[model samples]
Target: MTDMQVQRHAPIREQVANILRDAIVDQRLTPGQLLVERELCEMTSASRASVREALRQLQAEGLVESHNGRGTSVTVISTATARHVYQVRSSLEGLAARLFAEHASDQDRAAFRAAVTELAEETAKGADAAALLKAKSRAYDVLFRGCGNPVLHQTVQTLQHRVTRLRALTLAQEGRAERSADEVTAIADAVDARDGEAAQAAAMTHVEEAARVMLAAAEGPPSH
Candidate 1:
C-alpha cells in the first residue's frame, strides 16, 4: 500500500488504535483475551510499531492491560465494578445535562436534536450493536459540546472505553433501547426548554436504568 493509504486521515498507529478500540468496545475482543503484537499486526494490516503504539493507546484508555509476563489483554469488568462506574457516571452525566440546559446555544441545541433523531432512526431499524454505538457516540458529542465544563467533559471521556461494552449490552436487552431513546428525547426536550433540573433528572434516570439492566446481565445465572 502507498503512504497515502497508510496515513489517509491521521497516522497508521491512530488508525490501528481506533480499530482495536472499536473491536474491544463491541466485545469482538472479549475480556482477558490476549493481544499479541504479531497477531494484531497481521489482523490489522499494520506494522509492528503501529500495532504496539495502538496497544499502548488502548492501555491508556483502560481497555487493556499489559501483564508482567502474560502480555496485554482486554480488562475484565466485574458486576460490582460496573455498578460503581454507573454510579459515578450518573452523577457526572447529570452535571453535564444541567450545564447543557443552562448554557447550550441555538446551534448546540439543533445539533443535539439532530443526533437524537439519527439515533432514533437507527434504533427503529434494529441497528446492529456497532451501528448503535456509533450513533450513541454522535449523541454524546452533542452533549459534550453543549456542556459548559471542559474538565467535566474530559473526565467522562476518560471512562468512556469502560462503558462502551455496557452500552452495547444495555441496548441488546429487549425494550431497553426503546426506553433509552425516550430518555434521550426527554433530555433533549429539557435542554431545549432550558430546564436544567429536568435535564439533570432525565439524564440520571437514563443512566440508572441502563446500569440496572447492564449489571443484572453481568450478574448472570446463579450457580447450582
Candidate 2:
C-alpha cells in the first residue's frame, strides 16, 4: 500500500512474468499447462500474491488464460493470430530496417556489427537450439534499437513475444540455421552499406522465409 512497498515488489512481479513468458515462448509449458499459484510461488521464490499478480498480467497479455476451478494455462495460438502477427512483424521490421539504414549512428553501427559477428560465430559453432535462439533474438533486438523509433520498436517486441514459440520451432528446423545466418549477414551488409532499400528487402525476405517454414511445418509433412 505504501509507495516503497509497491516499488519494492514491482520487480518480483516482473521477474515472475518474464520467467513464465519465456517458458511459454519456449513451449516448455506447452499449451494448457496448468499454472498453480502455489507451485509458481515456490518455483519463483515469491509470495502467492506476487505469483498471482504475474499470472494476471500474463493473462492480460494474451499469453495465458484463467479457467475458474481449472486454474491458469498457457494459451494456444490460432492460425489467424499467427498470420496477423507475422504480417505486423514483417511490416514493422521492414520499417525498422529502413530507419536503421538511414539513421544508425557510428556507435549503433559498431554495435550491430559486433552482434552480427557474434551471431555468425555462434551459428558456425553449431550451437544448440537455445543458444541460437538467444543469439538471434539479441541480433534483432539490436536492430530494433538502432532503428530509433520507439513505437515501432515496442510494437515489434510485443508481437515477437506473442509468437515466440512458433519462431523457435521455425528456427529449429533443418537448414534454418544456415538460412538464418545468411539472412543476418545480408541485413548487416545492407545496413553497413547504408542502403535502406536493400535493408528492407533483406529484412522482409528473412521474415517471409520464416513464415513459409512455419506454415509448412504447421501443415505437416507433404502428403504421402
Candidate 3:
C-alpha cells in the first residue's frame, strides 16, 4: 500500500498521536505551549475524540500535561528532570549496546555500522537538527533491533519522545553534533568487535557526555 494509504489505515488516534509527538519532539510545539483541542482537531483533521485520545497518549508519555481549568500544554523539561532522565538512559542504552554487541548477527552488525556511518556523514556535512534526528533515530533503530530484548525495546520506546527532545537540544549546541557522532561511532565500533564491556562503556559515556552538554546549555552563559 502507498504510504498515505497505510497511514489512513492506521487508527486515527494513533496517527494523531504520532503527528503531535513529532511536532513536540521537533519543537514545532514548543515547551509550555498550550495545545487546544479544537485547534488540534482542525490541524489533524481528526475528530475531537481522536484528538483527546491522542493527547492522553502523549500525556502518558510525559510529552504533554493537563491542568485543571487550563487544558494541556507541551511539557517543559527542567534541568533536574533532564539529569534524572539521562541517568536512566545511561543504564538502558548501555544495556542495549552490550546486548547488540553480544547477540547481533553479522548482517545486523553491518546494517548498524552503515547507520552509524550515515550519522557521522550527516554531522560532518553540518546537517540541520531534523536531519540529524532522523539519522540518529535510524542508528538507534538498528541498535535496538539487534539487541534482541523485547523488554528493553519496549522500555526505551516509552522514554523515546523525551529522549529525542533532549537529543535535539544537544544537537543544537555548537560543536555537539560532531562530538555526538564520534561517540556513537565508538559504540558502533565496539559492537562491531563484539566487545560487550567496551560497547556498554562507550554507550554510557555517550549518554553522560550528552547530559553534560545539555545541562551546560540549559545553564546558559556563566556569570558575565
Candidate 4:
C-alpha cells in the first residue's frame, strides 16, 4: 500500500480500539458481551481486518477475551485484577508525586496550581458525569506531566487506561465528587509545599479512597 493509505488506515485501528475500550470502561459492553467482528466493523465503519487487529490489541491488554467458538467479550474485572491495578497505580502515582516535589520548577508548579484551580471550579459547577470525568482526567494529566519522570508518567498512563471503566463507575457513587475534589486540593497543596513525603502520602490516600469507593460499588447495595 502507499504511504497515505497506510497512514490513513492506522487511525482506523486506533479509533476502533478506543471506542471498544471506552465501551468496556463505561460498562456498556460489560463482562462477557460478545464483540462480534462483523458487528464491530459495522459500528466503527472500518474494515474487518482493522476490527480484528483492534480486538487483538485489546485482548493483549487484558480488556477483552477470545475463545475458539465463544468469540470475544469484555474481560471480567476480577478482584485480583483490581488489587494489582491499584497496587501498580499507587506506586506510580506516589513516585510521580515525589518526583514533582523534588524536581518540578517554579513554572511547573504554577501550571499545576492553575490546573488545580480549574479542577476546583469544574467540580463546583456540578457538571454532568462526563464533564467531571474529563476535568479530572485533564487535572491528573497535568500533574503527571509536571513530574518530570517519564517512566512514572508512562506507567500511570497505561494504568489509567486499564482502569478507566472502574474510575467512571466510582464517579457515579454518592459523595464521590466532593471526595475527589478535596483529594485533588490536598495533592496540590502537598506538591506546592515541596514536601515529597506529604505529596506521596496525599496521592496514596487519594487512590486508596478511590479503590474503596469502587470496591463498595462492586459489592452492590447494602442489605437491610
Residues 98-159, model 1: lDDT tens digits = 99999989899899989988888988998887888888888888898679899998998888
The candidate scoring highest on lDDT is: 3
Which ten residues in a row are the worst by lDDT in model 2?
Answer: 1-10
- State candidate 1's TM-score: 0.92
TM-score of each: 0.92, 0.89, 0.92, 0.87
- lDDT for position 75 in model 3: 96
TM-score (C-alpha) between model 4 and the true structure: 0.87
Off by over 4 Å in 3: 1-10
How would you encode candidate 3's per-residue C-alpha lDDT over 124-191 as one tens digit per residue? 88889989999999999999978999899999998898999999999988889999999999999899
Q: State model 2's lDDT.
A: 0.81
Clashes of each: 0, 0, 0, 1
Q: Please rank every candidate by lDDT, starting with the best.
A: 3, 1, 2, 4
**C-alpha lDDT score of every prediction, in listed order:** 0.86, 0.81, 0.92, 0.80
Off by over 4 Å in 1: 1-9, 221-224
What tens digits encode model 4's per-residue C-alpha lDDT throughout 111-219?
8878878777877888767677777787778778989978778877666766676677777888898788889789889988899999899888988898888887777
RMSD of each: 2.8, 4.7, 2.9, 4.3
Candidate 1 global lDDT: 0.86
